[model samples]
Target chain A: MKILITIQENNVAPRFDLTSEVLIADCRDRQIIGIPRTILMTRPSSEELCGLIIKENISRVVCGGIEESHLQYLVWKKIEVLDAIIGPYLESLEKAKEGTLKTGTILPGAKKIRSMK
Target chain B: MKPVSFATCNNFPVTEILNGVPHGVAILDRDLHVMEMNRFLEVLTGFANADARGVHADFILRSNIGNNEKLFRNVIETEEYLSISGDIISRHHKKIPVHFTVSPLKNESGDPAGLLVFIEDISALQCFDKKRHNMACLDKILGHSPKMQEMFELLPVLAHTDATVLITGETGTGKDMIAEAIHNASKRSRYPFIKVNCGALPESLLESELFGHVRGAFTGAVKDKPGLFRMAQDGTIFLTEIGDLPLTLQVKLLSVLDDMEFFPVGGGKKVRVNVRIIAATHRSLRVLVKKGEFREDLFYRLNVLRLHLPVLREREGDIRLLLDFFMREFSTGLHKSIKGYTPKALNILTAYAYPGNVRELRNIVEYAVNICQGAKIQKEGLPRYLFIPVEEKPPTSADERRDEYSEKAMPALDLPAEIGEKTVSGSWQDVEKEMIVEALKQTGGNRSRSAKILGWGRTTLWRKLNRHGLA
Candidate 1:
């Protein structure tokens, strides 16, 4: 099964000194290794994220922060969503690999962040 | 010193350290007035040094991290320091966890005043806490033997996987406990842990119990009953003693496990579920499959992640522990004040091979305690069979021939027997009396919960004392 983990945009490649974007540390138990897929920093709609999730053939999604409307949208889309995190981008990736991330909060703005100020 | 520029309004610029350099810095005074706010603070808070002047950190910082005014107060009141890690979503709704430390601030005279707060985004703490919490739940499970330990090690790894698990063990060997432990440790722990005992009820009942039933499906059709599978949607269900499941039900179970959906009994609508199956069996399902007692297809599906429980006899050292454990357990309920078991009795108990295992030993202990007189359980209190030697020389060939010719089960012991025996009967009291006497012989007159487990109320249990002429 392919699992997609979302970290802060700043964590991609040379921006952060991570050995790998997808955490393989705990993959032995899952008998699975994650495939790293990057989503640009611009705020995206839940439907848009769902499209991406489908494109990536994502069975599970892990991200640091998810807003309420988008969370509902993901719920409607039958896409699992989790928010609420404290850590560097890679830390969240490791936790996601271990299957221990918790329910994140509903972000102030739901699907749209342009007017979120 | 580097340009120590300050903004008069912001509270802490520590969050800037998480970035390339100190991007923001602010200082607060005794009345929580902004003493100094750096240029970095102005850019991040979206306030110029002039506009940010004299502003309180509370209004400027709107997040769980900024809400630690109480911890700040504690620092001021006790002249101590406090640090906490928590979540913070910025005005733009970019959520993250940060570490905050507050220390009592001193004036030019070194007198205590307000405080200096430092905030560093440490969302990593939340992730680490989560993993630690998961491990904590795993540690609650009992058992330390190699097999159990191996499974314990495997559980955390397995819990991460979305795989079907199979647990095998004897009755009351805590197979259900193992299933629960696994579920509790899994990613789906937040969801339900539904359980089904395949052997408890017959096929029709078991079917309805598993897949649910529509109202008016059968004779007891008073109301609609939701099946366990539906109840366990997006969760895990433990199917115990799966070998006892009828072949037809096995096929159905296999179908649902394969498809994640099933039709409710007598209901036209089909309910699709997202659930994991963790099955357990005491019987060798393989043997049953070969014997045509179990469905081969279903057996293979449920046997994926196999767990085996070792017999209690194999771990005899646990016997002494279990005995001491059950001793206190039975003593309280049986209301018998047993000081302890004699070494000789313990020897006899330890020497006997427990074919029935722990549960049987529990039954034996409960049975023996009732007949125990003093605080100590002596040899006389045990069943006579435990002490009898198997190799006794019987009468010659002619006598053995006559005994063999006898048709009764025990040949009625044509020769005189050693012990005194009498049969008694009477009123309801007599019936109770006879039953108690027999049970006492069965359990050795242990008038405790063990006796109650045998189905006699305590008072009726003691009636055996009077009837047996031992009172």
Candidate 2:
């Protein structure tokens, strides 16, 4: 499966339309197959991002908040969207590799702060 | 009298105080991570305090603060207040215009502890600015003619009330835009604005589309679907081409309008809804009713507030205004810096009667802008159909216009002796320049009233004046 995650620096971008970087990972059987490639976009545009996703033939997309229109368009194109997931992109990628990432998962506070508390 | 210190006021509920400020407030730690945020900020960003704590400020705000963290970090280092206006992506992924005030937070030792951020939503102010001036535009709709000016004055009055609006106009006369302007200015602006074309879908499908369907309602109905009325909720529903609405569905729509309730396709339960109806059509509903094809009661009900959009040609002096407007619009969109139209091209455009109205004019400008290579759009840049002699084209209902301002139409002008001699043999450009020079001379160099006399936009007249060296 080819998983694409919208990122801002090290974390998942808060909004898909405003993301300028994306991490594309190729995994198999819920495990990593190779080193993930990072793609940098010239601008943050939902239309261009949609075009890039289709051009790259991404199988699944993991990101934070996304508008309903773009989400539906991606889903209609047969690509799975795991949206509204917050925290670092690496952790999101790990979850995706393990096939455990779910939509609307807020990770940082849940795993780090809640555990300490 | 006692002066309270921060230590003395430590018992006060800081979170509650921050929430009561009426503006979004967030406290960030040294690394620009979210340490705490008030209820207003939480609601705006869609991140509860529990989940948002310890998250990076950029992720929490999702604003145009900076592409990276260096600019924000600099704000703390410089220890100066930074205020900027930009858009913030809300939790729903909607862009919200806002103003931000970022200030450094200091500790008891006067060392920087974190940052204090204040956000003020300004979308309402932006909306107000667009509708502020009593000029030739309302939102996106543009016109300068007396008839359009009358309609503009009446639009705001009609938008304030809940009366069903019936917009009648020729196709492409911006009836949909008028309908939208009403919805945008109305009290229900916050709700969805739904549109449905009565003639686009078959009667059976359209019925289900307008008034949803229950599970197993038909062969394709594996799941229940809430229709457009339900989707619109407390908003406005625009029914275009209302004349084509099936008579059976017309009765259902009338009942819905009367009682604010309707039954979904194959559903026994009645669905109650509150929605404003705005219907439009090019065809006359009265004619349809006379032919027994439309319900008279429904037609009258929809006609509570009628707004008729005049055809493009009927709106005197609007042709040149719209031409310049669309020319600049397409030029900017296509990344071209188009100066203006050539004299011959301008004459052909201003002379041609646009049967398709504003929409066709917009398409023509877009095509010309795309094909144009030089600073000015030439005759070849326009659609070839525009170059067809007026007599050769098929006559339209308004084709009686041939007698009014056919290709032979020319404003009576006292031509200069030299120009009068060339009237029979000179190029159209020479005659056009002479006509402009004479008009300016007749108006005593007053471009505003000169444009009116020539039935052209002020910008168009000014460009022609400059071209003729009469400015």
B240-349, model 2: which lDDT tens digit per residue?
99999999999999999999999999999999999999999988788789989999999999999999999987898998999999999889988999999998678767
lDDT of 1 by residue, A2-88 (tens): 555554333211111111233212244644454444545234344555566666655556554344555566667676655433234
Model 1 misplaced stretches (Cα beyond 4 Å): A1-117, B1-26, B36-52, B58-79, B84-99, B105-114, B120-137, B185-187, B220-226, B259-263, B267-272, B311-471
Cα error, residue B147 of model 1, in Å, equals: 3.2
Q: Any runs in candidate 2 off by more than 4 Å, and if so which? A: A1-117, B1-137, B390-471
Best model number under lDDT: 2
- State the weakest 10-residue window (summed lDDT) of model 2 chain B: B1-10
Q: Per-prediction RMSD in angstroms?
A: 18.5, 12.7
Residue A24 miss distance in model 1 (angstroms): 58
Rate residue B317 of model 2 by lDDT: 91
Alpha-carbon DockQ of candidate 1? 0.02
**lDDT, model 2, position B438:** 61
Query: Candidate 1: lDDT of B53?
Result: 43
DockQ of each: 0.02, 0.16
